[model samples]
Structure formats: structure tokens, C-alpha cells
Target: AEVPVNWCPELGTVLANEEVIDGKSERGGFPVYRRPMKQWMLKITAYADRLLEDLDMLDWPDNVKEMQRNWIGKSEGAEVDFQVADMPDAAIRVYTTRPDTLFGCTYVVLAPEHPLVASLTTPDQEAAVTAYVEAAASKSDLERTETKSKTGVPTGALAVNPVSGERVPIWVADYVLGGYGTGAIMAVPGHDVRDHEFALKYHLPIVQVIAAAGDDSWDIQQEAFTETADTVVVNSESDLVSLNGMSAPDAKEKITA
Candidate 1:
């Protein structure tokens, strides 16, 4: 949000405040130098109502509308915090549409850019973690995007599963991004895409808690099992009720409740 100012010494006069030349003086044909200056700022909030009105009349494509809807992502769910066993003061939190999958989470992943990644890494793995984080940072915004390769380094820290009281290893991975619902994520390989890839790469366990549409083949599932209306929750604890023949939204609410 910073503006640039140009000053020309040979002109003997200051250029207009809005003047922006490419490596040239606006007056007297002399070289201009960039100078930092403070100026009053205009508030864009004054046009908020006008902008909203204009958007209502604009012709936007369905894809753009879908993207906007996804961006808004106003989903109702619980934000559960799982404590890190090694780091008592720290916790890994994840927002899930199906809190019923809470017991099935076998690992926890923190985005490589997460602030806690540095401190959570053990002394022995610090060097490797640092290198991974630096490499991830150096990647261009496009290269660092979600579509890029899945790279990660184990943090040597473990998070306590809130429901099962089991300690799950914490990993710093690029597959998880800081801009998502949370910088950290509960790895449910049986039901999530990124987690499935990470689990395959690391040979981690993939437990199936939700049955797919047609087949119940967990071992042969080529991709993550998506939750749908006909999907059923299986292998859940006694306190967690089964969601057989229930809609995904209803099942999620019932399990979380």
C-alpha cells in the first residue's frame, strides 16, 4: 500500500505527486530519484455500499460464482483442539465437517509454514526440518500451490488424539497449508485427499471409518472416500453413533453433537 515519490534535482522543481516515470526524470530531462514521503490516505470503506450494489448487477460466470461460494465456506462444525503430548503447551487444531472421523485420525500434519513447526521439531530433526521449510518458502507462489508435490519432514513430535487418547506423530508437510481452516490438520487418509497421498508416501496406516458408495474396499481405494448422503459411519466408538443411511450433513451434525 506504499506509494513512491520522485524528485528531480536538475529540474529545480518538484514533479506532481502522481507522476511515476520509469527510471527517468519527468522535467528538465534529468535522472529522477525515488524518495519516501508520507501522505494522507483515502478510505475505501466509503464506497462499500456502492460496491455491493454494483456486484449485484454484474454478469458473472457460474464457475466464478462457485469459486466465490467455496471461498466463503460457511460450514457449521466444531473446532477441536488436540494436545501435543511432547509439547504440553501446544495443541494441533483442525476443523472437520465430520467430527465423527475424530477417532480415525492416525496422524497429524502441520503446514511447513506453520509457526509452531520450528519449535515442535526435535533437536535431531531440526536441521532437516529447517531445510525443508526454507525450500518450501523459496518456491514461487504458483509452485507452492496445493497442486504441487507433497513434501514433508517428520517433526518428531506427537499429538494426543482427543477422543481415543492416542498419541499421533506430528509431521510438517507442504500438503497442508497455513491459509486453510487451520495450519494443522488431522490426517484421515481413509477420507481425505492430501492425507491419502501423505500416508501412501510415508507408509502410514490408513483406517477406514466411512464406507464408500458402492464398495467397502479400503485396501483397493485409489482415492479418498468422500462423505455423501448414502455414506455410513463404521468402526466408531460406542459413544459415537453410527450414521448408516443418513445424509452427510445430518450425520455430521449428529456425530458432532
Candidate 2:
């Protein structure tokens, strides 16, 4: 059986050394690459704890360790269910570090490539949706990275705020991805980076739910403000008050409560 492989046109033969020439093609000076090949694979389920221990003992910088810890993302938060407007039985759920953002969620977004997008998109927007999806697919992986411009198509579907009972528009955007924590996200533009960009691009409402310490000089027009210190939940419809002297995590709980 001939197995699929990554073949560099410039390279004459199949690669034998997994690591060579700064991890480039050994032949013809082509850029060698690693592509998924259907082959016998070893399951590392038995090495989970051992691998974790090895990582803990590594002589790495604090920032690197912190990044690993963040990637592991072992934390506690509420799983809030948001009801989809117009579609009674359908809903999009998201997990957030700050449930305090629930009231600030001006819009909800699914990855442009999300499966639900097709079902949720209105008939009038079908053509536009198809075009946006095509454009998103044509973008290179680097171009689809988070730093790229926030592009989206209005699904014409709305998600009801579980707390406020307000209907927020659902948008299918390339900035959100199926591989992320959730394929869908409730966009609290006031607090999130990507959401802020999307709101600015679409001229959506951006309410500042949380405030910074000292002087409130953070400018949303010039840049995204994500400094999470001395945050106070402003314009909250609920009884949530200014989260003074509370860390972001604790503040989220108090506000949600």
C-alpha cells in the first residue's frame, strides 16, 4: 500500500532524517516540511503524568512555564447557556474567564467555518455567507491568524442574553475558530480583543463594563485595552457593583452572582 507523504518538488527523494539541515529539505535545497502521514502511530496515553512531571522539572523561564500553565488552562468557571433568538431549540454555549461580561455581550460569533453557520444563516444572506466563507478559506494559515483583520458576515440569527433577555445578533466570523475553546463565542467587545476589533469594523455598540485604575485613559479608538486591574463593572443591568480591590477572577464571580 502506498502511504501518503509530504513531497518537496525540489527534493529528489523521500526524507529519511526527521531532523536535518535546520529541519529543511536535504535534497535540491527545497524547504522540507512535516505533513500528516497515515502510518502506524504510538499512543502516549500511558506517559501523560510522566510527560507532565518532566515539563515541571525543566529549566525554563517563568514566562515559558506560565505559558504552559495557561495552555493547560485548569480553571473553574460557569458554563452559561445562551438561547438563540428565532430558533427556539437552538443555543450557543461559551465558557469565559469573566462571566461578568455576560451583560456586556453585545453580539455572539461563530467561526465562519462553523457547521451551524449554514443552518443559522438567513436566505437573504446566503450568497454573502458563501462569499465570506470562500474568502476565509482562501486565506493562508498565517493570514487567518488572530492578528489579521477581523472579517465577518451577519448570520441574521440572534442569540438571546440568558440574563438580560436581550437579543444580540449572531455573526459568523473568521476570527473565531472551531479549534478554539468553543467554536462559538459571546462577543463582549468591551473586554475581548478580537470582539473589540469586530465591533469597531461593524460599528457595533461597545459598552465599557470594566474600568481601569487611577486615570481612565485607555483609548478603544486607538488600541485595544485589556489591562485587568482594579476593574469595575459599569453599566451593569444587574446588581453587580464596582469590583474594587478584587482580582479579575473573583470579580467575575461576584458580578455573575
Every model: Cα RMSD to truth: 9.6, 7.1
TM-score of each: 0.68, 0.69
lDDT of 2 by residue, 178-213 (tens): 545566788888777777878998988776766675
Q: Flag regions of model 2 displaced more than 4 Å.
A: 1-54, 59-76, 213-225, 239-248, 254-257
What alpha-carbon RMSD in Å does predicted model 1 have with respect to the real structure?
9.6
Which residue pairs does candidate 1 place in steric collision?
none
